[model samples]
Target chain A: MRIPLSITDNIQEWLVSMMSESAASYVAMIIVALIYLGIFAIAGLFLVLIERRVAAWFQLRIGPNRVGFQGLLQTMADALKLVSKELTGTDRADKFLYNLAPYFVIISALMALGVMPFTKEFQAFDINIGIFFLIAISSIGVIGILLGGWASNNKFALIGAMRSGVQTISYELSVGLSLLTMILLTGSLQLSEIVEVQKGGWLIVQGHIPAIIAFMIYMIAGTAETNRAPFDMVEAESELGAGFHTEYSGMKFAYFFLAEFINMFLIAAIAATVFFGAWLSPFGITESIPWLGVFWFLAKTLVLVFLMMWFRWTFPRLRVDQLLTLEWKYLLPINLVNIVIMAFIVWQKLIIQI
Target chain B: MGYFSNIFNGIKTLLTGMSITGKYFLNSRKGAITQQYPDNRETLKMFDRFRGEVIMPHDENNEHACTGCQKCEIACPNGTIEIIWDRGIDEETGKKKKKIDQFVYHLSMCTMCGLCIDVCPTDAIEWGQNFENSVYDRTALTRVLNEPESKVRAGIED
Candidate 1:
């Protein structure tokens, strides 16, 4: 059968071959899934290194220069150390739940990879509900934190978990509301659809004043949701004694650490997809280049991730009350009202006319 | 009326806050405030009052003026110093000399507490202001600063 030819024609043919007389498509999909997981781990390692470097710059000191070649392999060494060390379980705690929490966090973060369309041909699943699916899966990492905290039977851990729950739930509303503004403008739930709309230009550049404002709102709320600094009160070292993971030791603690970094990348990647254009370049020029979309997308996300790490190192963690106030008093009302106005403007076709 | 004005004032305040950041961001012609250290250590000089490595005062013949009083040793809480003593043979008076012997100062164990200097009676010790003391071996850090016999004799006669 003759297929309608396009730029992804070669990719389509390869996928079709996998479906005929073999379990090749299933095997290929698993390989692609593992590739995405590898990307997550690699990104997490780089993010951890970047965070330390930025922190060193902020505090006017050199950081982690002793590890492999200006600390390039610091994360590798750290992971090896964590793996070799003991993973202790609390005697008083529910052993099943305690053992289960880190897995929950790691699995959910890995699940977020399924919805992310790395390129048109590079996605694991071409699901229609990709954006919301990402949001849903990534949020489960928070439940892991709460579970780990509660199961440990440590007072500080419980308090930290409580803080994380409140913070996560609060910031989630602002993020949702900010992103809702974009969904209203673009009129799609799927991330691929959103990227399609931004074929001409990234949303940050294409959409006028209101869209830019929404982008800023999303960035701030996403940073908080990632539990990075300025919003890192959940694990405020001074206040809560390592917060929710206080009772955790060795490998279980390592899982929690890895989860935090992966979530940071996930949020950044989602932000790249939503506001900056997933894998599209300016003026729909990427259609000619074939791979420019994915390149531009990864580059943009890495830049955003670096900026988030910079913010983490530059500022002291905000007080819990101050954090709540920023969300409730400022971000919430602005995003809520902004979406309503954007909806009206989009419906009337005022965006193009004006 | 005043409360409504406060909202406008709030907007103005935010703009003002943004403008300060704006000015700094735009002023790229100005040199960056960051300094890459260790690379630029050749021209580095500590401030006048910066406390760094400790030095013992030496006589013209290269000898320290410390006696075996062990006051500084007593003042050091971390036991970073070990003052070994030996009876001095007197050629004229035929009596033991109350002079310092082996003055061992361990840099590894040093907390940079200046209490030893504070307790010194001879005004022989002061901060060296030389802090590039990273050595290859731990044993190299354990300094044994004893006066040579010739210099000790010259100090006693003087």
Candidate 2:
């Protein structure tokens, strides 16, 4: 018997076959949500492990290797430790908002993960406004940081949160504009449709010069948006003493930590999907085997993730003023000009076709 | 003109920084400077002159080099070494010789300065390389350098 390639489709069919239509849909939604949650947790943990290992390597040291074979279970152990820790709060903190903050950050990141096309048909929610949804959802994560910082009733936390608000707002422009440049090439807002357009050739290859610039700008902005190092004004440990989540302890702290890694993965995944061909095998070598698309997608995403990790380890954190200068002075201007270039290229039918 | 040049130079410097780290990352297997202690105990070797602790070397005959000399005790800055000695007749020489009843070493007070080893007139004491000195009880840090019932080596001039 030939194995079905689309596991999601097969699962959907099985669910429908076994239950009433409405019930099947409900069951499918529940199952998909559960699966995405599992993925979010596992991916966050795995990315943290990867970041630690990569950071260690760059610093000429061995990272965690004693927990489980090459420290595979280190993050798992950390998660357990975090869960068992006492949830502490400041004496005079805003109780309601402080308690409510981490969920906002974590839920926003989890929602963004729903639309990622891991393979041809593996996406949980393949909404038509996929890119827009991601952009909108990702921006909501800033609210969590702001709330966490404000409700903590600490000066440093407030400063960090305010810096984050400023940084995210500024970089958000470059991120949208750069992705907007690519959108001009694909002429579609749908992520899968964007990937389908790349079947002729990857967007980066087709729209070579401008697309490369957009990719670079997108990477910079995306890294900033995630509040990662070099752009981690949100949690500038030296300046803000753990920043927005300073008052958070135990599982609440873990939620913020996990969400950061998830956001990094989201940024890299978006870069992988939009710039590189999402789940499309390079040169159609693995085209016959549709299942291999998942492998390719993950491999591409991991490469971008490693790039982000590289940036984190190599670059020092930007000063608050310098951060804004970079966004407004360099990235914004370049992104604006690149979008126009991309538009001109599209108008002249100058895109490279395979 | 300079505006664009500044951007280019900035990116170039950033790339240079990345290349340096990237080089180390690629060569990390051979370049990692961390030594996994305990796990690598069998292979780990301290330097020859590392002042881990003061020790008295004894032979197969249970004879040591120390002759109850107070030089180490006197040389120790913090009085980490203490010698309780008794005058005993040497059978071969038929003379009174100072022999240690207990050669106590307070490792807690010892700074590992090698002063005690340097000042031992009979070349009795030397540095030991066993540095895992932690103990639950404070009294456990006080060590007896000479083995119980051990005698001084024969044919050594005081």
CAPRI class of candidate 1: incorrect
Report the Cα lDDT for residue B109, model 2: 96
Model 1 reaches an interface RMSD of 6.4
Q: What DockQ results for candidate 1?
A: 0.12
The true-versus-predicted C-alpha distance at residue A235 of model 1, in Å, is 1.6
Q: What lDDT tens digits, residue by residue, belong to model 1 across residues A1-354? A: 432223234554587776762354445555566766788777777778877765565444566766889999998788788889877766799787888888898889878877776777666565677777877787788899899889988888889889999998999888887888888767788777887887656766656677887888888888898787878877988888998888888878887888888888788898899888888765566678767767877888888887676566545678889889878877888788788888777777667411
lDDT of 2 by residue, A1-354 (tens): 222223356666798798876676667777788888997798799999999999999999999999999999999999999999999888899999999999999999999988899987787777788899999999999999999999999998898899989999999999899999999998898888999999999999999999998999999999999999999988999888998888899999999999999999999999999999989999989899988998999999999999999999999999988998998999999988898899999999999999
Top DockQ hit: 2
Recovered fraction of real interface contacts per model: 0.00, 0.79
TM values, all candidates: 0.75, 0.83
List the lowest-lDDT window of 10 residues for candidate 1 chain A. A1-10
Model 2 chain A weakest 10-residue run by lDDT:
A1-10
DockQ by candidate, in order: 0.12, 0.64
Backbone clash pairs for candidate 2 read: none
In model 1, pairs of residues that clash are none
